[model samples]
Every structure is written in C-alpha cells, then in structure tokens.
Target: MLRRWREEDKEPFAVLNADPVVMEHFPATLSREESDALAERVEVAFDERGFGLWAVEADGEFIGFTGLSVPRFTAHFTPCVEIGWRLARSAWGRGYATEAARASLEDGFGRVGLTEVVSFTAVPNVRSQAVMRRLGMTHDPAEDFDHPVLSQGHSLRRHVLYRIRRRK
Candidate 1:
C-alpha cells in the first residue's frame, strides 16, 4: 500500500534509502538524517500539492515510496509532474514499483488533472526506464537532458526522459 508517512516509518524508510543497491542509480546512499529529511520533504509536498511520494508498505511494514513529484531542477521539460518509485531490495521483483506507479499515474491524470506525466533516470538505469515504459510513458531521445542537479562532468548527469499523456 502507498500511504502517507507516519512517525514510525522513519527508520524503515531510512533503511531503504541507505541501501547501496537501491541508491546505485543515483549519486549515493542517504544517511539516516538525510533520509528523514527527505521524508519530511515528501510530506510537505503532499500538503502543498495534494499528492506526493507516499510511503509504501507490504505485510503491514514500511518498504519504501512511490508517487508523483514536481522536479525541482530545470530541464527542457520543466514544470511537469513525474511519477517515480524506490523499494527496498527485499521488496523488489514483487511488481511493487509497477503496481504503485500505475496508481500514481492514475492519480496524476485523474485527481491531479495533469495533462501529462514524465519519468526519467540515468542512462544505465534500464530497470527504471522499463518501469516508465510499463507505465505507458514514451521516450524521445531528443527530449533527454543532462540533469541540472548533477555536477558538469558527472557520469549520471546525462539522463533520459519519458512522458505519457492522459488518455482522452
């Protein structure tokens, strides 16, 4: 289930974020404090936007998060809603990312009334790109961009973009 974060979720969420495998596509694993800060930000986004990356649970325990967010950094696709997810290694291969992401897109196009939603990942993150495709997002290589948040020479700076439009 993708639900709002609770105080008790801090530790589990931090454990998910601290996993090196889970953080591999990005720069680095988040420290405990950093993970907590991220949870706070996620909650604030929900308060401000009506929806954000919600905590995920399985077997009635925190696993990770999956939902919609507005990219803070500028790109050619600035001002777009994006669907994303991250699950603990143990929770992977269980269809959690795809299931939760499908729900996120439903909320994006339905409740949020967004015309379109986007998703992206580093060049090597075929796993996430696969999820984006599974969510019906199409990629146009021309739309790809160097992530603004990454350092100029960073290997992961070049990222691919995928977008899906709300069905008529």
Candidate 2:
C-alpha cells in the first residue's frame, strides 16, 4: 500500500538507500543522514505540491516508496511529473513497484491532472527500465540525455528517458 511517510520508516529507508545493490545505478549509496534528509524532503514536497513519493508498506511494514515528483533540473523533461520507486532488496521481485506506480499514475492524471509523466535512470539500470516498460512507458533512444546532476565523465551520467501519457 502507498501511504504517507512515518517517522519509523526513516531507519529502514536509510538501510535501503545504503545497500550497494540498490545504489548501483546512482552515484553512491546515501549515508543515513542523507537518507533521512531525503525523507524529510519527500514530506515537504507532498505538503507543497499535494503529490510526492508515497511510502510503500507491505504486510503492514514499511518496504520503501513509490510515487510522483517534479524533476528538479533543467532538461527537455523538466517541469514534468516523474513516476519512481525504490524498495528494500527483500521487497524486490514482488511487483510492488509496478502496482504502486500504476496508482501514482492514476493520481497524477486523474487527480493532479497531469498530461504526461516521465521516468529515467542511468543507462545501465535495466531493472528500472524494465519496470518502466512494464508500466507501458515508451522510450526513444533520441530522448536519452546526460543527467545534469552527474558530472560530465561520471559513469552513470548518461540516462534513458521513458514517458507515458494519460489517455484521453
């Protein structure tokens, strides 16, 4: 289930962020302080935009998070809502990301009234690309770009962008 963040979720979320496997696609694993700060930012985003990453719970336990947020950098896709997810390794392969992402898309299009949502990850992060595909998001190689947040020579700088539009 996707829901609001809880204070108890911070520890597990930090653990999830610190997992090397989980952080492989990005620059590096987040330290506990960084992870906690991210959680705080997510909470603030929801308060400001009325939509942000929702904490994912399974069997009544906080597993991770999935939801929508506006990308912060400048790009052709900037100013767009993006669907994203991150879960504990134990929670992997459970279809929770897809399920929660579908609900997020519903909220984005139905409630938030967004026309499109986009998701992106490093070129090597096929796992997330697969999730995007499973959600029926389309990718065009021509749309790929270097992630602005990553330094020019960073290995994960190049990323693939996927997009899905709300059906009329």
Candidate 3:
C-alpha cells in the first residue's frame, strides 16, 4: 500500500538511495542531507497539493516510493506531470514498480485530473522501460532527450520519454 512519508521512513529511504545498483540510473547517489531534504520536499508537496511521492509499504514493511510529480527540469519536454517510482534493489524483479505506477497513473487521471501522465528513464534502463511498457505506456522516440541535469558525456544523459493518456 501507499501512504504519506513519515519522519521514521528516512533511514530505510536513505538505504534505498544509497544502494549503488538502485542509484545506477540516477546521476549519483544522494547524500544523507540531500535525501532528507528530498523527503521533506515530498512531504511538503503532499501537504500543499494533496499528492506527491508516497511511501510504499507491504504488510507494514517499507518497500519504496511511488507517486506523481511535476517535472521541473528544463528538457525537450518541460512542465509535464510524471508518474514515477523507485524501489530497493531487493525489490527488483518484482512487479512492484508496475503495480504502484499503475495506481499512480490512475490517481493522476482519475483524481488529479491529468489528461496524460508521462514517465522517462535513461535509454539504458531497460528494466524501467519494460515496466513502462507493461503499464501500457507508449514511447515517443522523437521526444527522447539528453537529460539537462547531467553532463554531455554522462552515461545516463540520454533518456526516452513514454506517455499514456487517460482513456475517455
């Protein structure tokens, strides 16, 4: 299940952030301070907007996070609401990302009233791309972009954008 993040979740969340494999697609692993700040911002976004990255748990154990957030980075496609999730390395190979992301997409279209929800990952992140496909998202290769946050030569600099629109 998914719920708002709490202060107690920091340690587990930090562990998820610290894993080298888990942080592979990301530019770098987040520092403790950065993780805490991110959690705080997620919390504040939930409070202010009624939605943000939610702590995902199963049978009372922390799993990871999944939710909707507006992509703020300047990109080939900017100012789009995106559905996203990240799980621990132990949680890999499971359907958790797809499950949680499907729910987030439902919330985006049904409750949040978004016409379309987009998701993106580094071109090399086949695992995440597979999950996007399983979620019924279609990729627009023409929209692929070099991530602005990373340097030109960064391995994860190029990313592909996928989107699924709410059916009428």
Per-model C-alpha lDDT, please? Answer: 0.91, 0.94, 0.88
Summarize candidate 1's per-residue lDDT along 23-85 as a digit string, tens digits.
999999999999999999999999999999988899998989999999998888888888899
Cα deviation at 122, candidate 1, in Å, is: 0.4
**Model 2, TM vs. native:** 0.98
The window of 10 residues in a row where model 3 has the poorest summed lDDT is 70-79
For 118-151, candidate 2 gives per-residue lDDT tens digits of 9999999998999999999999999999999999
Candidate 3 C-alpha error for residue 62, in Å: 1.0
With candidate 2 superimposed using the best TM-score fit, by how many Å does residue 157's alpha carbon deviate from the native?
A: 0.6
Q: Candidate 1's C-alpha lDDT?
A: 0.91
lDDT for each residue of candidate 3 in 9-37, tens digit (9 for 90 to 100): 89888989988889999989998888889
lDDT of 1 at 47: 96
Candidate 3: stretches off by over 4 Å: none
Overall local distance difference test of candidate 2 = 0.94
Winning model by lDDT: 2
